[model samples]
Target: MTTTRSLVVPLPDTTATCQARRRLDELVKPVGSLGRLEELAAWLCGAHGTVPPRPLDDVRVAVFAGDHGVSAAPPGAPGVSAYPRELTAAMVRVFQAGTSGVTVLAREVGARVRVLDIAVDAELDDVARDVVARKVRRGSGAIDVEDALTPGEAEQAFSVGRAVADEEVDAGADLLIPGDMGIGNSTVAAALVGASLGLPAHRVVGTGTGVDETGHAHKVAVVERALHRVEGRVADPFDRLTALGSACAAATAGFLVQAAVRSTPVVLDGVFSLAAALVARDIAPDAARWWLAGHRSTEPAQSVALTALGLEPILDLGLRLGEGSGAVQAVPVLRAARAVLADMGSLADLT
Candidate 1:
């Protein structure tokens, strides 16, 4: 596996991207007729460092599961997620049993699914054996009152992500999908997005897991408090993540950075993944070159992150599922994009 003591994001192959764009124009379809698919094909070429990219046959989805200390709040308490913290561990079991939405969609798209136990708060015996263990901590601290992680713990989480990316790439994964499963993670995501993009907490916060108006208001307040606590102290992306992001977000960012360094493409899920991507982009500005936004999550923070990253989502089905379900839904679209480049005849050949 490739090791990076500190993440060094690599630049994409622009020459390959140009070559692929020319090839797309020469296809039987009119120039730009295929819209985003053509762009996706060209992007694939850039990411793979080839004119006509290989099929994304070796696709893998890594769902990093953790818990947020903020989730420890009772249902009626401020900053609580709609679901209990135990749901984090329970959902890992669901993923392990191949019963989750991500599992079904990965199966549909011929992608392999691996659940990573990043930092779930509870002890999970049955699901523990099936997951890739890389727990950075028991769970992240409540950001509303304190830093989510110490700088060292944040770095450790980032290293965990980078290691996961290296392992997947070395194991023959050409394409990666990042998913997150941590109750109250959206709160963390909102805080990170708000801090990174200079947006207000109210604008970034959303009703995670179908929170009612009262819960939504409470979440927003929590995010505002977190942002206030970290104001003027987030000197860089790493600091921002350490201050406001969850363990899962830090790991996801690290995973994304390493994937780009290895020249592997990644499909990003919802707001949590986007929050991580924002931090990764700050760490390595060129890392965005390897990522494709899989969908537009209903979460407001997702839009902020996508806008900041300049990524247009392939799907916009109002999806807010966090277990990489939205990214899995986008796999078929990427496969179809690849097919357009691989199977379509050139205009000359058609004539």
Candidate 2:
């Protein structure tokens, strides 16, 4: 498959960022008093190429849904996911009904939600008419034994993501949030992060979806085996993604790259999204400029990925849910930062 080098992502303008900082310093409040809020506003100025960045009025969250072949493990299997693969399709329905955590939070933040069925295994019934139907395959192959997708399939998944990002941008979405909802995705995410950072599985794996102690141990072992299979072979980001073997993650990474190409800011959620971000960064180093770590997840790999990317989470609520819940929670903070920059009077005006 071709790498993302062909895609041109513009770097944030440092001159505009400096101007934004200067303007913030002149606000009525004390210099640096707003803490991270001031920093976020300046970063927005750099991203949007405006001294006073526009408010994130039209935020959109795109939740990519898929299934993992590993999720089909037998009942007595050692490394089976806690939830059934059927939940992947069921949750997509929930998202469409506007009753899922992501929908509720999107409503609270005034952001629109789009559920993209990138590669769910089962045929979904009663799905909303608007859900993007870009299924690459029934699901990804088992990563522990074989590559998740052939080179062509991997590229197709990336195209699905890029198309979705383009569509959203065309619809006037200024800010983007990428989310994941696939059974066994956390296991795939842990393996991807562990392999990319050269960390052991025990260090990066976490108890996903309330797995028991035995299930957690099994998960770690599964990750270990998968990483061992792909170790020393993941010379590039695309290789790492194929090694990890997740369609949803590949799509999310693609979406992230496309959003950055469009100069749209992204708030990434949890380990799955962070794992994709790691791959996206490898594909396009400057893509990191348009992303913010929405929240720190309980999963250990999240910290590893965020630290490697030089991003600090805006919120740390011990959130482990992956339906973009944590990222949506941080939207208000971005809004508040933009509001401060746009609405606050200058010290000269106050005097």
Candidate 3:
């Protein structure tokens, strides 16, 4: 009973992929000497439907920021997250200011960043107008005891994601990266993966933000409770999203789906993006074809979701940062792959 949507996700271009493989075989280096780089080049060629794959000059990293109610607690009391809830909005401002790690990394890779205020609890008055214009609500309800978003809000966030993809693609974004920003997003993201894979809380939960053993146990209990509440609707992707995920996650799902639909490639960050992409893949069927797991995350849910998607991460830096920093780090790897395909000397050149 997955959330069946009216959408058609196209497969990658086999002709271009085969062409890339053939050309890769002719590279002056030993056959397959480039190893995964060869595979990556072929993937790029397939995704772009071009023999050598076009340059990824206009890479856009979209950070979806939102607040999760599961992070709420009584005054002076702690909750699922180690950081204060207000940091979500603060980081959004940091992203807009172009000072965060994500911004720095994106700039180094010849890309740009866009920060969207999907559901941060704060007013974010200091942030740029365009950054906060897409707020879905003040924050999501606590998934441990209440629904994260209403049906309408879930759809709205998803639609916002699709619109963002369309906006970026229409504006000539050759590649897209969807990042996550929230205090307790890892918890919700793990829950999304659990629902998609029918796993228990212990199997899905992880030590997000270096929570202590006590904090880890509490987080597991909280996710367990949330899973219990959604047991009946686990089969419905949107229902699971509405009950256990946040506006950011839903928007990410939409963003990934629309990127695939538009035949644009995407680099997924960590577990946050993985969970959302899991739901996106379920809804759109073959959307995973347009994605690359940017890096391996410390979270087990990240590996779980990657395995489910049949995607192998490009890097394994143990990055737990969720601001799309990990994916941005892989931009250079993509550049290297594209370089080998576009610039490397071929055996035919020697002839």
Point out where model 3 deviates above 4 Å. Answer: 1-6, 75-78
**Runs with alpha carbons beyond 4 Å of true place in candidate 2:** 1-6, 76-80, 128-132
Query: Native-vs-model 1 lDDT?
Result: 0.86
The residue-by-residue lDDT of candidate 2 on 181-215, one tens digit each, is 99998888988898888999998989878788898
Top candidate on lDDT is 3
Q: On residues 1-351, what C-alpha lDDT tens digit does candidate 1 reach at each position?
A: 223455666778899999999999999988999999999988888887886788888889999888888777754565457778888888888898899998998898899999988888877766656464587778888998888887677778888888899899999997999988989889999989898888899899999899888889888889888888988988687788788887788889989999998889899999999999988888888889889999999999999899989999999999988888898888888888889888999999966
Arrange candidates by TM-score, descending: 3, 2, 1
Error of 1 at 164 (Å): 0.4
C-alpha lDDT values of all predictions: 0.86, 0.87, 0.90
Candidate 3 TM-score to native: 0.96
Question: Which residue pairs clash in candidate 1?
Answer: none
Q: lDDT at 81 for candidate 1?
A: 77
Better of 1 and 2 by TM-score: 2
TM-scores for every predicted model: 0.95, 0.96, 0.96
Give per-model CA RMSD.
Answer: 2.0, 1.6, 1.9
